[model samples]
Target: MRPNRVSLVMSWLAMLLMGLAGLFGACGVSAASAAEAPIELRQGTVTTTVDGVTRTEPVELSYHWDRQHNGRPGTASFDLPFTLEAEPETPWGIFIPRVGNVFEVQLNDALLQTYGDMKRNNDADYAKAPIYVPVPGKLLRKGDNLLQIRLHADTARLAGLSQVVVGPAASVRNELFESANAWRFTGSVLLMAFSLIVGGIALALWLTQLDVDANGMPRRVAIYFWAALAEFFWAVRMADGLVAEPPLSWGPWGVLMAACYAGWAAASMMFVYHLAGWANERRHRWVRWPVAGVVVGTVLFSALSLQRDEPAWFTAWLAVELVFVAAFVGAFALATLRHPNDDRLLMAGAALVTVAFAARDWLVVRLSDAYGETTWVRYSSVFFGAVLLLIVLRRFRAAAVQARGSVAALAERVAQRERELAATYAELEAAAQVQARTHERERILREMHDGVGSHISSAIRQLQSGQSSSGDLLRTLRDSLDQLKLQIDSIHLPPGDVGALLAAARYRLEPRLASSGIEFEWAVDEVEPVEGLDAHGMRQLQFLLFESISNVLRHAEATVLRFEAGMKGKTVQLRVIDNGKGFDTTRVMPRSLAERSGAIGARLTVESRPGRTVVQLEFD
Candidate 1:
């Protein structure tokens, strides 16, 4: 759903341009006679035309051998012999592609063109579609001239079909040149357009607010930028000389063209290297060396100011260029076979470049002699370039989408963590509030114990010393002082059951239980309010509970204890029963009663059984 508008538009434009290229390929005339040249003719097809040249006009020059002439596989000769009334001003030429069998062209019954062995299989590729060659302009005389062609279409070459056409040498030559021009110009335009679009998008991305920390660097976009620059220079050379006469100087022009191509190729290869997960350690380093060398060499050659033209140097450069392309292409093919990312569109685009470039170059070389306007080399390159451009654009878009998704996921995780932090902070604040209130209460209790308790003690001392008091009044004053002292010393606990505190105490005493051979168990079903308890009281109760558990373990040698906490009306019940030796509850009862007359005495009921004693305590 994260649509990058730049990538989207780039992808669409590249695709539309590529489609236009394909459509452009399908245009033009496919004539039956020699007037319309054969489209994409091969080796064997060339021989058929050679044989048909012997006969005059109205001759059946068709490759549909299966229809009539028996479907037998063998050499067949046909003729389209022409008789000249006067010497023609324009030179004439015929395009005879290699057919499946051996073929020879004869003018005035003289040998003109011959290819392949008579014994070779008709299934050979060279015989299928060879380049068109021009006939010598001097061959035509004032009188009649016979063109006899011989073709071995069966068992002589690969599946080859031939088309023979005769036209003015100048016109055919121009057409031959035009075909190359078509591919070059068209390819240049497409490449330039794509480069511009991709470059613009990459620049835009570079300018955008990117989540770099989480997403890593956008290396793919960077590669695309370099590729666009390379393609721009590449288009310049091809487009500049497209319609220019003399085809511009080949040396400087070739160097620039080669450099551009190498740059784009290297950039594309690097992009795939990273995109396909092959950009690791040794591989990346190894591939980059050759790419760099090629770019450097191309630039150097482009700048050299040598006036003398060396075709050999250019040819050698081309050979090296081809080798370089092959090396990267081989690596890419292997990568494609191993890749499981399912980026087939990209793979297909790269494959087309391989086939188109290889095929176009091959044809241009073979058909150098009989070159005409309707050549296939020119169209294929430009058209396929456009196709590949579009493919890369689509892949770029996909990468953008993946990046956006990762960003969104990271954002969600961050939000969740923020919420958790906020909740923790809230709990911390509440605990802090409770602590503040407890501190205030503790301060008040300390003041009362120091100030009020002193005054009461002084009053009791005065009364006992016979300072104007009746006996009943003196007794009442003494009881009031005792009550006031008790109240001041007592602590306030939080208004909550003691289950949580008891659980914590037990958790801490587990080690003691283990050493004393005691099994402790506890359960809390309900937690009632501590009606009069406050924070101070809760702290005092916790400390007392710990001290009692310690005494049972140390003095009574308790083996097993059961602690239960539950709600009983408005009071919280906390009980601990232990199996241990019995203690003298009556002896301590009197001392505890004498120590605290107004308060209930600490009560202990010890029941001794066969092997154990039980004692319990309860507080509200």
Candidate 2:
């Protein structure tokens, strides 16, 4: 949606366009015709005075000071004497459609109104406006009345007065107001405000996009720069005309006006050229000379106006600037006609209309015979500028919307990629779990081979050799059973829990050892788990302890068995002690126990004596 104020302005502009014709038509009914007893439209004589050489011209319907007194600042007067039956009512007025840079009106030698002070400094140019003045009935004698109009012109200004209409104040009031406002009192003010606000916004946005445009490219920033430059100075030019009292004197004010025009024209040409695809580097290089000439000419004109007394220098520079404007307008119209688009055609038409009006105004200023004509460009350009402003706003809004769409599309792509990554992570996690389960199965098989298989093999060997009775075979088979119990118990043991490991082996062997008349003493101190011990390492230690017990039973001929496990100062020691008539020390310590202790990074030792024997594992 458009901003609220912009929407309101567009709606009002549409309404204005729809009623423009009717509005002007109603205003066209002149007061000279509208009065009941209309004042006769008659010829009047104009006296021109220049360099103290007074010249009187023939009476006509209107007056124009010819080329003889043109460039010099001069005075001109129009005198109209008429006969009336009676004195008119108190509030009679006259409407003159156009005057000069400044003027004063008098009836019967009494001053009625003066539009400007003619103070010789900081005076405004009223040549572009129409004026109406009310009259005092006392000035209208019953038999004769004299209406004199006086005007002052600047060094280059045209001195002219239009045909006058005398009637009741109401008769001339509306028409005069309409004609004056036609010179763009309302239109220029509105256009100036619109251009300033819109141009400021455009320039600010261009600053943000210093090297890029709404399409995220580098091309369109130039377009925005040109648009803002043209509009800003156009508002300045409009302000020069709109203000009643300029900050500078008339000469400097006019010079500033031309400079503003030069700036606006150059910027407008570049703006249209870029839009129409005529802004290649080669064309810009060719056009640069003319644009530079305009700038140089403006500076030269300013210098000359201050240095010299002639008005011709100012006029020449201004005319050169107009030629530049005409060339650009021609190129724009030709391009639009050759390959028309909606935006190009609209701008082309506006260019043609505005330039045509400007040309008429230039003619009225240069031609001696042209009189009573207000400036046309003052009105036409403001209206065309409004249309142009609307076009720019539409394009800017569209670009903004497209940029937003691009950002949204990029965000959607990123979100899709994140979802894909999340799914991939889940698949990887599942694969890792399957690999871990397979490794655990292999570890379980290795432990069962070392513990249960070894026990059963020892039982089979004793039976084949016939070296033991049925009781010995029974104890050997039971040891194999205890290995199975330890394996089953290890499945639920926490990682590196040595205490639970020792407990499992003790529980299974206690009953059998007690039945064999061996007292079992279990001593378990508060022990910390070994650092870096893993599931596989715990299984090795479990089987090693079971093998130690077998050694005590089979070889030590032990009657008392003691198992001790705990942390001792900095070194942890676990031992199995038996009190018996011991066997050979070398034979009692199994090679398997030695290998298992080395696997768990502990040392294995065995000591055998007549009264006692010990199998011990030590950890540093």
Candidate 3:
């Protein structure tokens, strides 16, 4: 838990940090008196000169400057004189693990190896890298051999060295510095690659959410955006260790690294705020002030790096960054404790462990080790990535469930509407059937009254007047029964059957015509059925025929009575013609016959000429 790491991790939480092996490089490490072990050059004289103040001290296997010159720019020379019995082997090497930022090695005044150019401010952080440089076999002598380590120091990097080991190539390369090399160089590359992949996918998913989904988490699952932003910035910040020849030089690259570091910090806080559902106006400003401070601090730190004389300005910057980091870490820890789930709680626990590591760095500051700002917190960045993924998946599952429910609800509504429509149709059909039955009943009553009732009234009138014979009264009653039979017989008749009425009337009243001494004949033609000539129209036709037959028997006094029916073009014509002592042809029409003819839209005409008369009806 470096202050920056625990804070928004503003210093770039997963920065390429000093190697773990560098922490214990000099502790209890020795080349014992064995034939195969290397020779340990522990005994040496160290000369330090800083700002014109020079001091010399006896050196040990591990050494550092006095605390007074810790952050000052200075130089140190480690003159290590070793006595060898003879040139032990050829093509040997020297292993000096965890030195200052830069240094060089010499054997008998001949420059043997260099870490890098110490005079320039390069992009790499050499304090993290272990030193294993080759020494020539020709430079070694039997006695009075000298090994020198010339070290350069800058701000924040104190004059220091671990033990020096002069041994065979295998001992120096494989035994001492191999594991340190793996952790510092190889591990940094792997972490950068892994973070880049994680960051890239997170970024893509965030972009997809931004482009498509509009609901779910507030601001459309914005936690993914923050998580992606944090991871992407961290990946590039980690590249500071592996990128030896960067695209930009030291000043611009440092500024870039600072921006990425501060950006990661702000994004992580934003992600946490959203995760806890605390991104309201109150807590939002809490994030904003710190972010503003980081922006200002980055600008100031960039300005400070440009000044060569202000080597201690870096310590000032780190001290101020410490204050910002402390406040951020406090707020972050509080929020983490108030997190919603076990996953976030796990992240908090990792931060706490990293805090313990950073606490060790604080307690042992005078120890002047390269584990100053370690990457212990970076070990748990996976927790953040995992939680972001979980939120995205959970939101997607919920959206799917809601969509399915909506479809099911819509289907149910459609089914309900269809059922209602079907019920309404059934009701309408039933109403139409009831109305038709009512109309049919009325039609039957009208037919009985007009035909049967008319005949019964005539029979009663003859009896009451006391002028009718028994045969005549009985004939009128029989005519009433015939009218009822005709009404029933016309029920099965189709529309526009012009001959049906004449044929039925002849069958019923033929006996009467014979009793009256009159013959009856029929002449009708087949006609096509017509629309609108329904059962009611047929009843009207029957009444007309009955009335006309009764007139021939009572008044015509004829020998023959003939009924004629045929189609005259599109019109249907029916004529009742009789030969007897006929009545006057030119006279007012009988109201009963005229009324029914008009009701059925039939034309009634009468013609009389001494011995013949005809009542004609035409229907179009």
Quote the lDDT for 23 in model 1. 71
Give the alpha carbon lDDT tens digit for every residue of 91-196 in model 1: 6676543233456677766677766555543222233233345677677665555656665543111233345545565655467534533444555466456556
The candidate with the higher TM-score, 1 or 2, is: 2
TM-score of each: 0.40, 0.59, 0.54
Pairing residues by index, what is the TM-score of model 3?
0.54
CA deviation > 4 Å runs, candidate 3: 1-33, 52-56, 61-70, 118-125, 157-160, 210-220, 245-249, 281-284, 305-339, 358-620
lDDT, each prediction: 0.51, 0.74, 0.69
Candidate 1 local Cα displacement, residue 487, angstroms: 24
Q: Tens digits of per-residue lDDT for model 3 on 56-136?
A: 988776765434465566778989998766555546788876676677888899998776677765434455667788877
lDDT (Cα, tens digit) per residue for candidate 2, span 461-496:
988998778988888788878888888887877767
Better of 2 and 3 by TM-score: 2
Candidate 3 clash pair list: 1-354
